[model samples]
Target: MVAVVTALVLLVFIASFRFYARFLGRRIFADEEPGFVTPAHELEDGRDFVPTKRPVLFGHHFTSIAGAAPIIGPCVAAYWGWLPALVWVVLGTVFMGAVHDYGALVVSVREKGRSIADVAAKVVSGRVRLMFLCFIMVLSWLVLAVFAMAIAGLFMAVPTSVLPVNIAIVVALVIGWLLYVKKLPPLLPSLVALVVLYVFVWVGTKVPLDLADTGLDKDQVNLTWILALFAYSAVASLLPVWLLLQPRDYVNSHQLVVGLGLLFLGIFVAHPSFDAPAVRMSGDDAPSMFPFLFVTIACGAISGFHGLVASGTTSKQLDKLEDARMIGYGSMLGEGALALASTMAAVAGIGLVGFCALPGQGPVEDLSWAVYYDNWAHASGNKAAAFVLGGGAFLQQLGISAVLAQTLMAVLVISFASTTLDTATRIERFIIAEIGDALKVKALQNPYVATMIAVLPAIVLATMRVADGDGGVREAAWALWPVFGASNQMIASLTLLVLALYFWQRRRPVLPLVIPMVFVMGVTMFSLVLHLLAFWAEENWLLLGLTVVLSSLILWMSAESLGLFVRLLRERRAAREA
Candidate 1:
């Protein structure tokens, strides 16, 4: 069952990319200028805007945007059932998510590589751009703060990951030197780095470095790691694209391929059964599947964050304008592929490979997939760890050692998050510079100043002590996740709105973009209302207030977009009559 289902989902992705994507390219976004130079060449600075080959840029783009969300989102969303998670991820990435990402990349490339937020000034109005920038800033702030905490926590849980992850960084630096300075070919160096990466993955198992032994409590160690991670990301965000970000992400992309291949290959061999339900629509404990599922399984299907990454960094590195379709659409499919494997791991793969069963369930004959997902709370408890356990189990089927498999999975999670952390910081830097230009603050426009401003507050958010359950202190920024999903989707919908207007103004077919835009926007608005109610009932006024503000801004922007479309239609009608 696992093998067949996996093959079917893979087919959907392949077919969608082959047929659906081509239809989109020719019908909707037909403005591709064959000989046009991109901003990567027009504005090459050796730092942020150097032209890059498509394969290399695709790696950078994919890793930066993927992070752990694609894995975490689907794994957690399995609460409803693997069926809904799988269906949404596959369908969403194909129709809505890939379109959202591809549209933003193409639009940004045409607009001189300005972020979608900045491009808003051209598509709609300057004030709308301001509103968009504010949204970008808040989302970025939450991403940095939340991801730092996640990586720190992972480091504590999987101490074996500490060494290999760090080693990958050094390897990335070396690979960067080889690629850019030495002018070496990319394929051999990257392939070699991947092999070296796995070697250290094995070594990490033998030399696990636990921070708890250093005489600090869990919270203290977590905070220390968070601070250190921010410092590293700050430097990473400021470095030239060739030095660290690009080459490292390229390597991480390869890591993702190997990691994914393992999971799928495991599903094929193990052929696990579904211990979880096919369509778990309701439980007394689970949230309704209608709107929440859309947000819960957000990143793999359609994500606002992907649009940010596309316009923010990837747009500046296109070696050719044609690469947008492949990089933009292809990368989203890559993410969907990851999400699919994770869903299988949570459901059938884990059931076949085996998991550390629930507290009382243990390793009994009844230890099916349901033992791990019998309750919504259990499924939600440890998202990435669940994937690692199941995926690790799958690896074990291939004769890999349990310790090595788990360490490899842990390293993949940490690497995905780290790439996103630095990339988000860089995007935030761009946002800050754009914000500075808006406010006419010349100082904030400086890249150094912008990056500093971006990382510091995030560090404080991630490391700041707040009341933990029962009385201990912890970072409060992790609280932002509930709203982050909805807001991120909102970003995607609005990006589509911008694209819709871009096409509508030029007398092109917009139904393709509009369909997804409307659906995403509708679900996003619905999900935000539910989030607001939950926060209100829980008396989480901070989040409630934030949701209200975010909702109001989205509504205002929606209205603004509507007015622009209304005027455009009127003008078109008048021209038709004339």
Candidate 2:
């Protein structure tokens, strides 16, 4: 209840600031010239820099920013208490997340779409740049492996949905090509494609796949498929905007907006009661504490991952730096809103029907590992059934048949995983490429070559997990979660540190950066200790190994920042002397 109230209060505060900040800032600085010129403006290419409508751009940015984590974290954390999840997401977003995301975008645009790695190289030291890249690369590989397993799990649950989603993707690609590459208007074709895709969802649902061969039902992370996916990303990211990434993202963005909108609508309409406690604490309580909370609610609140999107993707497409605040900051707020909506789902999506369907009598015990398969299946079935019926109402109005609606819903879910996979692979490849360059590897000097280096790690990691058998995906996810949370928070910490450093050097107000910097560092450090302690207690060697690696990386990064701080201080002292 406290968390819920806190979340609501912060949400209101951010929403107001997001609306009026730019207007006020613009009015106050009307006489001043633009602070920076984006690379897009200096070297405009219609391909990436084509002026898109604000709403359309918002849709794209929002979709790229929203991913499976928002949904999964909330769902998993719901087992603990929706109140903590909701409060953290809201408060964190307003204070830290929005600033990080918006700042990353604005900074990247001003720097001409150069990535954070490049930013570090220019603003800090080469070592710092290398650290940023290496950290991100590792992050990407973990993300890809985890998402691949997630997709596999979803496929195993309802194998019939996979083909429909794959088919929908192909159809989406065709629509994108015609619209962007062919220079045709996208409105009609996209609409038609969506309608047809919805139809496929309905028909595909009726076309049943035989589950008689239950042995095939088990999800084995096919390394080959994952590698193929990475291989595709290597080629895709290298391709022109008129091709893969742009088109896929465009379609995905539109679908995401619609899906999220409908979901929000459904939430408001159903207004289901919350079954979980407002502030239930974890047994060890370590995982949900300060440091872990920051990491656990990464994207839904503030994520370093968004910097990749802002610099790597969105900045390249900005027609004007003037729009940076809107695209960068506004997009973050939008993401925050999505996270809030997810929190609402976690809090209010459950009903008596869902509770009764569970294996155990109570919420806490129901979420335990001891929960049986029958209970899981029953709950999953009940929840899925309710969603299907609820989703049908909208689908029917959209002219989607009952079966098609289910297929469509499944397609959206699959696409989320697929897009996350491809995007994660590309990001990882970039990270490896940077590391290779740092190590003076000849192959990684070339972007294409570096991407290949990056792809291999993800492929190998995903494959190995698949080989581990039952709950391989789940196991892989658990292994990555702590590291992912830590690295994510570390990135947030770095961003705040950088902002603080920049502001301090400029002799401006440093409170904003200083406050967040200290808070996030506390969060990251706390989470790291918890993870290490858990590993020690359980004697989980894999986790222990992961914690060790992550701790080393964090220390290395911290050292880089401290050195930067000392260098800056000395420079300021010298400036005052002069």
Candidate 3:
């Protein structure tokens, strides 16, 4: 019965998203007109703007946006109970995330494939454009920093994932060469690559690699992986889209689909019941769910980061305007599905391990549910570990050995996260170059120079250590995640504001976009204010300053947008009177 409920819920969410997609296509986007030339064709250079087929583009977009966030956020947020997390993931994706992504894609498509920041310049003002650009650069920096640390942590914790991850990169390069250099058909080559990658996953299980076994201290091992990741990002950022970014994501997308299928099948066979509480408060230490929940589960529900991917990279590669609906909105639903799976795993798998109590909360017998989640939340650097253990437990039901199942789960996460890391570096490079153009700085305009500038700060932040409550030091990435979530959600609010302005200018209805914009703005600002108070109390000056900057920028943009809305309304009324 429990398994049946889970399956039904997932199916219903998917079916509803499909219907919403159709509605959006007809009423909002108004369908792609014939003879419309996409930027992929008009600006095709066999590089960033190369025309891509639907499946390949969807794969790239989905994998790029579907990083560890969806998995990690839901895993951690399950502390409030899986029921609330599941609700947010389902509704947020259908209404908020998909709308933001699809709108950004269509608006960018119409604007010659410019980013939402660029569109803000035309629709709002040049000053707004600059502010948005700055906001995005900071957001991207955090993304790169956090994801790099995440992949490094995963590799260190699950060493078997290391070999498969590196091997997948080699496979991607080979696949890139075959598809682009040799002019082979992509379908057959991508399929063959997928098969070979899975074979490698099996090989990885047989011989897991551990960095700690080499006699290095924990910090030293982490530093080694961090440096290795940044070095790879530098090279990957400079490579053409056809070479590394697109092909690698395409392969990772296949792995994600296969992994999800097995997880769901395992759930059915295992019939894992809900183990966590339906709704439980974490006392005064934890923030209430109101704004925190919305921001914590950003990617699964709605994320501003997807707007950057949609406009910054994906729009440039869209072969057809019509495809944006699927690539934009459909990909979000795919991520939501992943989040749901993670939530289910966290709730079910945590119980099997016999440590289900909320952190600092004593165990309670005779509770309705079998597991406690707050305990997992308090386990530093173990959020990802929890998800892996939970997911592995599910896979175990499929007759896989516990060791092999955990390794497979680790490979799935590391591959997804690594795809996000390099892609973010590339996106950050683009933003840096655009900032150069905005500021008229020649040196910064060079992609290589801009990439190095972006990478340096990320590397430093990723490697830097800060003192934790236990008097032990932890990587700065752990400290920055809360701020990252707030900043990320702010970006979503700003993107929605941009979309609202775009729709208003065309005399279209803006209610569909405006409601989510206002709601996200309110929730994110509330959360940021709370974070600001907390950071001040702790004397974390670095994060405190960042919070101030982001808050100020968001407020400034909001004021400017209000002014624009008023002006646009007056002009429309005047034109009607005339």
Best model number under TM-score: 1
Error of 2 at 262 (Å): 1.6
Q: Candidate 2's residue-wise lDDT over 1-578, tens digit each?
A: 42344356545756646564454224421212455555666766764555554544554566666666665555445445666777777677666776666666666666677777777777777877877887777777777766765565455445567556566557756865786668777666766766666566555666644333544323333443454556666766666554555556666666655765665555445444554567655453224444455676778777777777776667777766566666666766766665665555444543312222231233432322123112323222222222333333334445545455545555655666676566565556556665776788867767677667666666666656421223333355435665786777777778667656655665655565567777877778777887788767766677678678777877777778778888988998998999
Candidate 1: deviation at residue 562, Å? Answer: 1.5
Tell me which residue pairs clash in candidate 3: 356-372, 358-374, 358-375, 359-374, 359-375
Can you give the TM-score per candidate against the true fold?
A: 0.96, 0.82, 0.95
> lDDT per residue, candidate 1, 31-80, as tens digits?
36778989999999999899999999999999988888898888888878
What is each predicted model's overall lDDT from 0 to 1? 0.86, 0.60, 0.83
How many clashes (backbone atoms < 3 Å, residues ≥3 apart in a chain or on different chains) does model 1 have?
0
Error of 3 at 80 (Å): 0.4
* Candidate 1 wrong stretches, greater than 4 Å: 353-368, 464-475
In candidate 1, how many Å is residue 511 off? 0.8
Candidate 3 achieves a global lDDT of 0.83
For TM-score, candidate 1 versus 3, the one ahead is 1
In candidate 1, the residue pairs with backbone N, CA or C atoms under 3 Å apart (3 or more residues apart, or in different chains) clash, namely none
